[model samples]
Target: MLIGCHGIPVLPPYIISAIVYGSLFALMSVSLTLTYITTKVPNFAQGALVTAGLYTGFALLSINKINPYESLPLSFLVGGVVALGIYLVVLRPLSRRGAPVISLMIATLAVDIIFVGVFGIYSDYLYQVKKVYDAKLFFALTGADFSLFGVNGVVYTAPIALALITASLYLVLTRTRFGLAMRATVENPNLAKVVGVNTEVIYVTSWFVAGGLAAIAGVFYSFWQGGEPDIGSVLLISMFAGSILGGLKSIYGAVIGGLVVGSSEIVVTTLGAQYIGPWVTPYEPGIPLLVMVITLLVIPGGITSVNWRRLLSRGNGS
Candidate 1:
């Protein structure tokens, strides 16, 4: 009787999709947040890192005779390693030289362009391999599909897994000594170095952690979509949307922002616009980005860092 059907609600496919979408966005937001805090650069290389990781992992998934379930961990490892490589070879050296911020952004953008070109080449190779051989070397990856309390619940396990991951990450960032040092570095690097915190090591560690997390995000996304190439096209919009919506500073806000982008953009725009007519029908994917731009214009700082609460507090003090 606990599973009572008093007023049974139907869960739409778009809703389920948004949940998965948002979860991935949340992960990306975390990566952006990590680089932003530690390196003091927006890390425009982030998108490229994601694409590179996706293609590289997809290559491995295509070749391996082993279970895809097993390959997932290794794919994620490849992603992290790739992210760290970009940091070491590209961003770190430039950052140390006190390079212009715009120059760094452009450099990262160049990295992104290179990644896209390489990814296209790799994708073509995969297509040729899949076509010329005309053979599908099957790899078993875990998935689940079942009713959730009599509702047609079809959620990929990866999204839920990622949510758990964010929780664990939150704990690590908030609780660990390394976490404190990381925060210190963000607040003031020179001071942290003077205090003997080894800011350079922390910088490298930030890349590792963030890159590893981005890889994890990639895996979750791949798992959610059931394959590769989804990372670049689909994730790019939602990831940036979530990070911006989250106010770019608060980890908690990022999670909430991901949910908002996922739910509103996918479910609302897809379904709600259906009733309103075909006028705004095709703007579904763009909604998140539009919202993000509008949001930043309205509150330049972000949702979390907005000083409304502080203003209220001052009023209360008065």
Candidate 2:
């Protein structure tokens, strides 16, 4: 029941909101899965990349007065650089010294802690020196926006960004030589080295791509929901839930898991508010935790491991 400025119509607010949020979640899940595949690290610092992108977008919009869309590429580069630095300086050296996976994962936790401090300091600086208002958890998506056909810029852009990233990933994984090398390294790093593939380069490239995707998703998310310095930490659970729901091993499964988790989080919360009480909305974040716990108990392998054809046949009694 929404009318556009050009006399066209767009989806209702709730549906549009779900789609936008779900798309961003899907993008993050895919990015996370990619990182896990290549590095065998769950990457707790992934959330910091999102936070970095959020601030990058805020700086671009508030200080530079740049369009949000224009900030995405810059955010991607910033994220890539941060990710590369972590890998090259910290993770790579640890690996060279034969650190275990647990040690590497802990390293990511350290990185996350460091970034939180950096984000907090920057927030203070922006508020005090730059005179930005409430910079810590600043909700900046107020009057600054553009409209497309009949939809807000974010409404169209979020899904489009996800689609482009997905398509590009498919092309890179299937058609590109670098992608082949990456796959080889992920499958068997030792074997890849024996076969002349540079595992170091593949690892670096994977981290870069993962960071870029996380940043892009953060920018899209900030567009619709507004940004906060620690917003990524809050979202880390949902990201993990989606990746786990997807079996944590398959990229395509991550997409399905994210869509399901993201859409259900909103839809179920809305229904809960309607039926249970309005107060249920405040506990919306609990939904992902419940989903993740139930998923681990019922189907640890996740949606990708299900025999969909058999299940459909049983439904038809065939």
Candidate 3:
């Protein structure tokens, strides 16, 4: 049982899990939304880029014995570089040739498949050369965590990281000249280019930022849920759901959408298991899928598209 700072019982494990998962999901979703806004391409390989970060942190921890938190900077760089490479090597050339959006999306899917194979090869290398037998399939390294008031360090760290990242993004986007250029580029690339905004640089910078954010989220996710080669693939659905629910067009919306969907996935699944029996546990992934479907059917434009003020005024009038 976990205790609070004052010795009273803290929230349940499942709730803690929800907070950590939701925070990570929000981070990843924000990254996805940023990429979409800048490039207008739904990066199917976003999950694989995250997995690259997961492996980066995992490799440092498993081999160098470095703390996962300490490995974050390197993970960010690796993820950013890979994502930038993908954009330059694959997407940009295709876009230049006037490839359609669907083709660009397919290219991303192909990249994801390639990443899976690469991760598999790396996993084999870890097992064969490094002798980390569980490199391919491993559980969380919770033993590396320090307890805070009997709660795992991640419980606080995850939310703190999310808060800091979001705040930093808000400042960067609002206060910087580059951010103004980025906004303009996203709004209209040709117009921004005409004004000498260097839209190409903005696109590269945005992809790098998005990849770094996803990788940072990946590092935390490995700490919370364990690292695996295909963990990103497993998480892709939830990330997309969060992005879509948040109204893919708004970065802030992604945050809220991620928190809601991630929390609901865990809480709803746990509740179902408790009340409906263990059989419901296997259907855990369905929760986010259902939420996505319902969101699409009802509010296709997402949470950000809804006019809460008007709705409230109408309620008052009634």
Q: Which candidate is the best by lDDT?
A: 3
What residue runs in model 1 are displaced by over 4 Å at the alpha carbon? 1-10, 65-68, 129-156, 226-234, 278-281, 307-318
Residue 25 shift from truth in candidate 3, angstroms: 0.4
> Quick one: RMSD of model 3?
1.5
RMSD of 2: 2.0
Query: What ranges in model 2 sit over 4 Å off?
Result: 1-10, 140-142, 314-317
* Each model's Cα RMSD: 4.5, 2.0, 1.5
Which of the two candidates, 2 or 3, achieves a greater TM-score against the reference? 3
List model 1 lDDT by residue over 1-318, tens digit each.
132465655456666677776776777777877777776667666765565544445455556544334555675666677778778898889988989889887887677667667666666666686552311121212232234665322255546666677788778768998878878888898899999898888888778767766776665554445434323555666766777888877677777777787667777777767788666767777888886888789876677877778989999998
lDDT of 3 by residue, 95-189 (tens): 99999999999999999999999999999999999998989988877876667877788889989989998898888888999878888888888
Please say which candidate is ahead in TM-score: 1 or 3: 3
- Cα lDDT of candidate 2 equals 0.84
Among all windows of ten consecutive residues in candidate 1, which has the lowest summed lDDT?
132-141
TM-score of every model versus the real structure:
0.81, 0.93, 0.97
